[model samples]
Target: MTSILIADDHGIVREGLKRLLEAESDFEVCAEAADGREVLEQVERTHPDVVVLDVTMPRLGGLETLEHLRAAHPDVKVVLLSVHGEPPVVQSAAALGVHGYVLKNGCATEVVSAVRAVTEGGSYFSPSVARQLVEQLRAPRAEIPDPLGALSGREREVLKLIAEGLSAKEIGQQLSISAKTVEAHRTSLMRKLGVRKATELVRVAVRYGVIEV
Candidate 1:
């Protein structure tokens, strides 16, 4: 049997995943945690074979929690799950030696497969995630240069604050700049980034590792 741990901030989500995992004859949920801190605590105690982790948890969050777990329990497999397949998170988790990654919507389709694959010492990434990774790898390496890299220091600062979810006024106050100036920088950054709106900016920010989703 494969001993597993389910870690997600939402109680309902965790319970749902637990039920699904438990339904499999060879899989069992040995532990469950509502957040990253609890995940660490439970894993140390249970020593589960696989960890199904959520990326947006409170405290340490999934990536950082996985970092700790990898150092402390190298034998355990890690499968990162999230609602959004942010490129930076996916790429960073890949670099950190994660066994697999699955999006929340893909949970029904990919979670079990990811768990089984990772437990068997193989890598698993959902089809959508695979497509996103390919896009990310190609986006920065494509015929065109990364426009964000062309940003001036002040423009980059503006984008960071925007990605942090700060209002124009708030960012201006933080940087001791006029709100109009902040807006102008936002416009410039969006144009350079080829993103039409704030939401797309956040998407780009996530891709570039400028912000966590």
Candidate 2:
């Protein structure tokens, strides 16, 4: 059997994925984890051949967790999943030696293919993200811009809404935070992104796909 460990923050998602994998006669799911730390624990215990990890989770992020796994268990393979097709995050995961990148929106078949690819010692990148990587490879590479580092998750959320052209009141309503908090996020993004003007900030956020604008 192709031993597997599935990792995600959502119980429903993990349960669904587990059932899907179990249906495949060639695959065997050995463990499940709901966070990065639990991922490490599962890996240590199960030593599964493949790890399917979600990108976003509380505490240590998926990519960071993968790095830790590579250090301690180089024999195991990993396939990363994400909703965001952001270039920087994808690139960083690739550099960390993830065997595959599968978007959660993809069909279950794609997930299986990703796992098989990694198991066979080949890497996989989801179609959309792979295309982006190809374009970037053709272009001149620049120093990685960690412009979003200082911004908290809440701040990032606000910046994305702002970039999507949502008014502060609308964003505040959506996030359940006050309008004052929304403004504070904008100010934090401005400082972290080093933008002097609202237009400039929006432009930067849009370019990064942090917001829809």
lDDT of each: 0.80, 0.79
Any residue pairs clashing in model 2, and if so which? none
Tens-digit lDDT track for model 1 on 1-213? Answer: 999999988889889899888888999999999877799899989999999998766544576677788888999999988876755557667666788888877649588899999888898998888887677777755553445446655675677668778899998897789999999998999888888887788777667655456
User: What is the TM-score of candidate 1?
Assistant: 0.66
Encode model 2's per-residue lDDT on 1-213: one tens digit a residue.
899999998999999888888888999999999988799998999899999998765444676678888889999999998786887667767767888999878787888888888888898888998997787678766654556544555665676667667898988997788999888878877888888876687787656544332
In candidate 2, stretches whose alpha carbon ends up further than 4 angstroms from where it belongs are 143-213
Model 1 steric clash pairs = none
Q: lDDT of model 2 at residue 53? A: 93
